[model samples]
Target: MSPPEHRIIAGIYHLSKDLGRHFSLTDINLQVTNGEFVFLVGPSGAGKSTLLRMMYMDDRPDSGQIVVGSFVSTRVTRRTIPGLRRKIGIVFQDFRLIEDRTVFENIALAMKVTGTPMSKIKQRATKILTHVGLYHKRHDFPKALSGGEQQRVAIARAVANRPAILLADEPTGNLDAVSTRNVLELLFKINAGGTAVLVATHDIEMVQSFGQRIIYLENGRIARDHEKIFVGDVRDRMDESRVSRRAEQLSEYDIRDEENE
Candidate 1:
């Protein structure tokens, strides 16, 4: 008999949060499994990031049972957070790399804090940097690298310790076509490696192109959730004149017809 997969199983039962006297999340429920790549789509102020923070254990829900993997997150003690974090990776919209740290140091810092051996730290950092295609910029500081490069460095740091789940928020925001493709491709590779990835982004077009299991939020509720095929015709005809204006840039990086592996 085979052992169970190390799945990042999540169950948010009636999740809610207090924000200036109102509940940010209104009874949210969700679940995911290993090797699953899920996308979260919603407009600004929609509770996407708040939900992610809860999953990452950064913020506790006001009322609900939140569980990830085998741990109960709702009332998880402070002493156990570090251990829980070791099993999860989180990427932010701000690209939270230390401005003073070089790319290699940024990646190594995660393991260093966890008391990883110095010998293994160097090897692990280098491998993740190469994995994200940032080996050439390993010596550069965050301020010196472009937005996309900095984000890749952030990704390398997140994956350096080999996390079971990765939660990324607006990872491709403000990136050019090429940079977005590169970063998303790196994420796809990570997902292929069996790490569950959940990315929150509002790029509807990109969402349509990537074609993954999506959890769409609206007014603090689960508006839509499913894996759907990318149909360019509907989108193109919805706003014919608008799409025509942006067709050149859109077509350059569109992956609507690409065969999913």
Candidate 2:
């Protein structure tokens, strides 16, 4: 049997992106290992989308090395990029499914591009559609579905090839409360199946519930990286909700230290 692959699927070393005066990512370094579930959290415009884009090869970093599987983002040639992408899957907040295609066709096409056989494509499409609770609408066009349904199709298509790493940007941003829970649960199910999942989200309750490793960003830098601990929801009006409470606590500590000095 072939030996097990490296635990680290991707490694980012001193990665940075600058668009003239706008710096999206600054000296960001991290790693996504095998079967790990990580949340990329931050306030608006914290460069969360930019980071995921760089990971999936939508854009290259202005400076730094991103090693995904075997290809290095800084050095991956255009010709080799397509191959590099075959090992990674990506989903966006906006459902990018083809409006003209049926739900089954949307997912089937993703696998077809990878040269999956017609018979296997049919089987995989049915299985994934059922998994996402969309098999009943397999024949429906994306235009006929709601936002949540469309997003579900996008996710099914993204994972059609069973990639090693799944990058999701606000997967539940367009979903309703129930749909949000459904999608989040589906992501957890996928992660349980051994696909390393990295999600960038704002739903504090979901993060608090899972209590997974959270990578919080601020001003294009990883402000904090740690697990979340929910000490009961306060339902308060304070700006420092559960997500920012850690930062708030750190600020309090600093104040106490200054007073002691």
Candidate 3:
């Protein structure tokens, strides 16, 4: 295994949030490793959005800390927040593209704010727009596009900087089934290229089949953190019949253990 410094992408340690009479989050602890894809699932009031905000330091926890790359929430300042945000890509359910800007300008703006040179911005924005299948619509404004196309543009803008981590909150909430699938495929493609993705959604059924790590939040607390297991190819590749039988036995034991618990 790699060292913690090399492996971990984001870490939340004993974080909590208080919204006066109601608690938004309580003692939340979680870690996302470099290049890992994870889902944060819960009901609407489960503080999923709050946690994502905290991770990006748009809001700070009442206690404890959040560490993303080398930026620490406790130590980060107003002037440095933009610097931290540059390392993270954030996507929202609502397509937040500027109505007046063209698709190309929307993406280019992300790079521009970071002082990326005009030539490099044009090259990177063009490449990202092509990747998202929106190159043809580069000159079109947001109001001229459909909901799905607009979301794709939003995603393109989010990743224009090639951030280390991507935090998406209900990215598919407003899309139809087909559009949702297309958006998810885009996210998977981004993840495959080595960006750590932490997507927060209330639709468990939509993401469960992907076989990635899932953390379940309920009432501002983590109810379960489940990791994926590989049983398909490993089971089929067993050298001997007895070994296969042994694997089956172990599987049975695991099931029984879960039932007992």
Candidate 2 lDDT, 131-234, residue by residue in tens? 99999999999999988788888888888899988999999887655456556667778887889889998654557545577898888898888853533222
In candidate 2, where is summed lDDT lowest over 10 consecutive residues? 232-241
Write model 3 residue lDDT over 79-161, tens digit each, in one string.
Answer: 99999999999999998999999999999999999999999999998899999999999999999998878989998999999
Please report the candidate that would top TM-score against the real structure: 3
Clashing residue pairs, candidate 3? Answer: none
Q: What lDDT does the true structure give each of the candidates? A: 0.78, 0.81, 0.85
Q: What 10-residue stretch in candidate 3 is worst by lDDT?
A: 232-241
Better of 1 and 3 by TM-score: 3
Cα lDDT over the full model 2: 0.81
- The order by descending TM-score is 3, 1, 2
Q: Estimate each model's TM-score.
A: 0.84, 0.83, 0.85
The better-scoring model by lDDT among 1 and 3 is 3
lDDT tens per residue, model 1, 154-180 = 888888888888889999876666566
Measured on C-alpha atoms, candidate 3 has an lDDT of 0.85
